[model samples]
Target: MRLRVQGLYVMDASKRSAHGNAYFTGFGKAKRIVFFDTLLEKHTLDEIESILAHELGHFKFGHVRQMILQAAIIAFIGFAALYWAFGSETFAGWFGLPHDPGVVLIALLFAKEPVSHLLHPLLAARSRKNEFEADDFARRIVGKEPMISALTRLTRDNLATLTPDPLYAKFYFSHPPVPMRVAQLRGAVEA
Candidate 1:
């Protein structure tokens, strides 16, 4: 992803990796930001700006640092769990797995999948809260109408349903439901 400010665009090299799944473009000269093609499609100015504003919120609130710290903590915990679970030959034999540290590390990483799945809802809920905070920030800066219109357009473009299962949303979503978001914006506008 890229961030632009005063004619300069900053993008991490990792963004170009084959595993890259997100992209952002901003008017460096204009000090404007944009994120492209995630759950939302690129279409209409309002949609683009709304998404951009949300991303800008991340930058504004230091969410990136929070994400990094969270990842590091999780990784450390995962490693500790792995070590404790397979520290002994007897333990390895009990599981019928190899006793090699390298093999154990790999297995540990794979074993974390279920743990990750179980933690997904909590993570997604935090993410959704962050999204809401960003939306709130965007509305404050750009006015509720633009952000609302942008959100609506992007949701439609992305084929996001107006309503989603609460359980599924908690488990899988990183943003609030579109209708709820729009309502928030509207309420802000009315207030």
Candidate 2:
């Protein structure tokens, strides 16, 4: 689908695949955004536009840059910790590994999960905030009705429960709850 917004053409493509899920790629040189065609088929044009607006919000608000910086910092800290831990004979012997090259490799591989687990909650919270900012941008550009309807359809199609545990929502949900989003939109429309 090609959407002309603000004198630029946003082309949504569908060729990128990762772990059986569709990935969207934006080409700065071409000034186009490519996403899975299945998304287009499943959503109305207005909904698609809202999604695109959300993506543009990320671009406009420097969320992508923030994410890149966060990843870099995490990687640096992870590598530093792994290096320090692996250098200690006590740490190596505790994990049943020899103080050798193999031990270093094993530490690198095993450190990923622990690091990810430690950072998951903070990352999830940041992600949810970004989603709300994007939604606000989409609402401003496409109006509350289209964005709310689009969000509802997506929640229903994705089999997302209307209600979820607040703890789970804070720890995992990237987007706000459907009811909360819809209510916000409705309030905006009424105002």
Candidate 3:
């Protein structure tokens, strides 16, 4: 499994905030991993390696490409919907909107808000599943204890929500809460 990681660098994020994070970005040969300076300050080398492994899991699973494709499909659907709305006078007339392109476009923006909200759970669920897969991949590479320790430290240092409401998490959280992730890692170790 060749990652073809192009660059590894740290950013001076502490100048603005103390939040700690690491991320993998780009596609194919352009891939890069970046760590917030604050993360280096807060975590041990082992923890950092665990986090790096987790980021690499995203690359291993092709999550970046999957996300890009999902975005493209959504954008295409949105444009198609807009085109249909523009041509359909009944759609505009239903809301007493003028059968004009500009007016219909404005109405579409308002109309899409509810649909976006409805779609939030599905999108967030996929994102959270990807996060779990990444966590598990890191566990496989670096051991669950290190990954769990890194996650625990990240949650504490970042002042993350400890226990979000289930419904809220389902709808909004792109990653499982720290405690949830830690529990899953611990369970995986036993199994």
Candidate 4:
């Protein structure tokens, strides 16, 4: 993992938002881990290390590449749909608009919410599963307590929902609710 890491950087994220976050960017041996300055200020060194371990898990599991591939597939489908719509004179006409690219784009914008609604559950489920795997990996690397503490702080600091409607979470959440994650961590520890 050390060999794969290219750099570690701290961004002045506090200037934009008080929310704390960290992420790894690039791919393979060129990967860089970037931490929000707010995260540095708010968390203990141990907590930061736990977060780093979680990110490392994503790399180890190739979650990043998988996400990119998923996005590419979605984009390809979207572009294909757009191409089809362009050729169909009835596309814009369905929206009571002219058969122009600009008008079609506007129609697509209006359609985006419903389309996203249909796709969100599947995408969110995959993302949540990845998050759980990452959390487990972090537990293996740094133990569960530090990661749990970090999650607790992040939830409080970010004003995140501790619990949410199950259906709503299925529709919109990419990560499981904090309480849910913490329970899973504790359960793993007990196991």
Candidate 5:
């Protein structure tokens, strides 16, 4: 079950953030695996290899495609709302939105900001779920203990917020918190 793909690209991102990351870029056969230089520098060979295993798991399970589809659907819904708003005077009147078409973009942004905040938790939950699936994929490839070690190492080296505010993490985090991910991996190993 070899996962076939394209190149691996390493990036220097230490100046931007205290973090280690790996991502799959491009699409289909052109996809490239990317690694932060900090990640290569900080982690052991096994840890880095386990991280790659996890990324491959994402591709194997089509998580990347699912995310793209989800994003497109959300964007479509947003555009549909805008189309309806622009076409109906009664809808515009209900919101007291300015009739000036040029200012609508700015007005829409202001209106959506608060609404986006309310949607943040749901979005974060979906993203965390995807991370868990990827972790499961990694675990299957590298074994749970190694996957846990890799995730833990990434968190420590990146100086991740170890004890984030629960509410804030729920609303903002794309990946599950480090300890939580480690525990999940441990649970998988036990089971």
Candidate 6:
């Protein structure tokens, strides 16, 4: 069987941010992996390979499409809610705001900001689940040890807090904390 691999791009972002990150970019078969050059500098080769395997897991599991679908659904719901609110006299009277496009735009921005903050726990949880799945993929390909090492190094290099407030993490973090991730991999290895 022939194996097909997509493009890998290394980005220069050392000047922009202290943290290094990676992403899967492009669409369809053209799907590519983009990594910060700093990631390569800071992690070992095995760690990098493990990280790539984790990204491959995302592709194999079709998470990109699922996330895009989820975003589309959220957008539809947001638009529908705005439409309903714009038509309701009570919304205007309670807020004492006029019905204007500019007003609508401002209201939409501010209203959704709060709603997004309110919904953060759920959304972040979903993202963290996906990260776990991807990590599992890495474990299968590169073994648990390599993945755990990679994750630990990545967290350290990125300066992620080992222990963060549960509420703050639950609301904002897309990936599970480093200790939790390392422990999960360690558990799998022991199993």
Candidate number of the best TM-score: 3
Task: Give the Cα lDDT of each candidate.
Answer: 0.65, 0.68, 0.90, 0.87, 0.79, 0.80
Clashes of each: 1, 1, 0, 0, 0, 0
Candidate number with greatest lDDT: 3
Model 2 residue 180 CA deviation in Å = 2.8
What are the RMSD figures for all models against the true structure? 6.6, 5.5, 1.9, 2.7, 2.5, 2.9
The better-scoring model by TM-score among 2 and 6 is: 6
Q: What is the per-residue lDDT of model 3 for residues 1-191, given as tens digits with 9 covering 90 to 100?
A: 88778899899999999999999999968899999999999999889999999999999999999999999999999999988998899889999878999989889999999989998888998999999999999989999988989998999999987888988887899999888888888884221
Q: Give me candidate 6's TM-score against the actual structure.
A: 0.86
Per-prediction TM-score, please? 0.69, 0.72, 0.95, 0.87, 0.88, 0.86
True-structure lDDT of candidate 4 = 0.87
Best first by lDDT, ranked? 3, 4, 6, 5, 2, 1
Candidate 1: list runs displaced more than 4 Å: 1-34, 37-47, 89-110, 188-191
Judging by TM-score, tell me the better candidate of 2 and 5: 5
What's the true lDDT of residue 120 in model 2? 89
lDDT for 158 (candidate 4): 90
Candidate 5 lDDT tens digits, 93-129:
6667666665565666776888788878888898888
For lDDT, candidate 4 versus 6, the one ahead is 4
Model 4: per-residue Cα lDDT over 11-54, one tens digit each: 99888999999987777677888999999999999999999999
- Residue pairs clashing in model 5 are none
Which pairs, if any, clash in model 1? 7-28
Candidate number that wins on TM-score, 1 or 5: 5
Candidate 4 ranges beyond 4 A from true positions: 1-3, 90-102, 188-191
Q: After superposition, how far is residue 82 of candidate 4 from its true place, in Å?
A: 1.0
- Deviation in angstroms for 184 in model 5? 0.5
